[model samples]
Target: MTARKRLFFMQLAGLILAFLVLEWLAGVFTARASLPYALSLLAYILPTLPLFGIIPLSLNYTNNNPDLPLSAHRMAPVRRYMVRMGVSMFFYVIILMASIVALDRFELSVQIKALLAVLTALPIGGIIWAVSRLIADPDVDEFERMIMTRSVMASAALTFFFAAIWGFLENFAEAPDFPLYLVVVVYFGLFGLVQPFVRRGFR
Candidate 1:
């Protein structure tokens, strides 16, 4: 196999492994311990991660390769994959919201939570698609790639720094109320902020 193909296969395998690990962890901790539910959720959710791979693959295949036309049959899988992901995310959201409601209610049934979770995931599907589109643009140029790489590295560094700080604060401070998610959101915003610098650096 070509290097590209090998990379794709490795990525695919890594995603599958990650999905399995998530499912196993969820099963062990959460009341939603059903294997089928875990597997289904993973199938629907994990595709979002590798949507990045699709952009590069599509660009590589289509650019300067008139003879190798975009195969509809091959592309069909990606569409189906996205659809599954959307459905899964939508239901997952519903489940979370419903669980919140269920906790308030008199009964606490696993089945009820599971059903509500699936129902909640519908709207989340739209958000997932939006996120996928935002990140995976087919027209990504060399400059964009550099920006994205640098942004990701910066984000990673920021995350590590924040994690260490949070750990220290927990140990030293009386009430450490660090908003980790907000820090992550800021890091995500930094991607856009650093884009100009990245472009200038390349120039």
Candidate 2:
């Protein structure tokens, strides 16, 4: 396979592995802790893993191809991809938010919320993958490829940095007391901030 494809596969595999690890750790914690709290914590933590996919999709859209720049007429495919991605993400956010709100109104079990979150994310992931495949130009040059690589690295670095900061705060403040949703907010915020960097690095 080509380097770019290889990078994409490797990054995807890494993400899957990370999610598995998180799931295992969460499972272990749940086994040891009170069931309700464990389920709630897992529900909040699990959604954040899929949020990482946004970085790759954003980088793909941003660094599509610089040399063979799209004509206004030829840009429709890219524009369509952007629109699809945007709409899918908006719906995903709305679903997640509504789920949280619903939890407030009803005695929605944490396991149910977690399952719904995962199911909702699957379609969003499909949309992102479809849009990326549709929009990415196969003729991307070496420099553009390098830019894409840097963007992915930058996104990973930023994700790690924010996660570390939150870990530190959680440790220092003894803030297991805080709502689980706050951690999800932090993850979403970091993912959003990193997208522009990914876009700018391509230019």
Q: Write the per-residue lDDT of candidate 1 for residues 1-203, one digit (tens) a residue.
A: 66666765676667657656864554454444433444544433444444344444544544424544446654444454455555555555445534553464447578866666555555555544544453464544434445667766766677678678777888788556776535645665665576667668776
Q: What is the C-alpha local distance difference test score of each model?
A: 0.55, 0.59
- For residue 101, what is the lDDT in candidate 2? 45
lDDT of 2 by residue, 1-203 (tens): 56665676677777767767766675576556655643554454664565567555645744564534656545555556566766666567556645654565468777998887786666567564743455265544445445555554565577667667767888997645455435544544554566667667556
Candidate 1 wrong stretches, greater than 4 Å: 1-92, 106-139, 177-187, 200-203
TM-score of every candidate: 0.38, 0.44
Shift of residue 26 alpha carbon in model 1, Å: 30
Which 10 consecutive positions of candidate 1 have the poorest summed lDDT?
A: 43-52
Scanning candidate 2 in windows of ten residues, the lowest lDDT window is 135-144
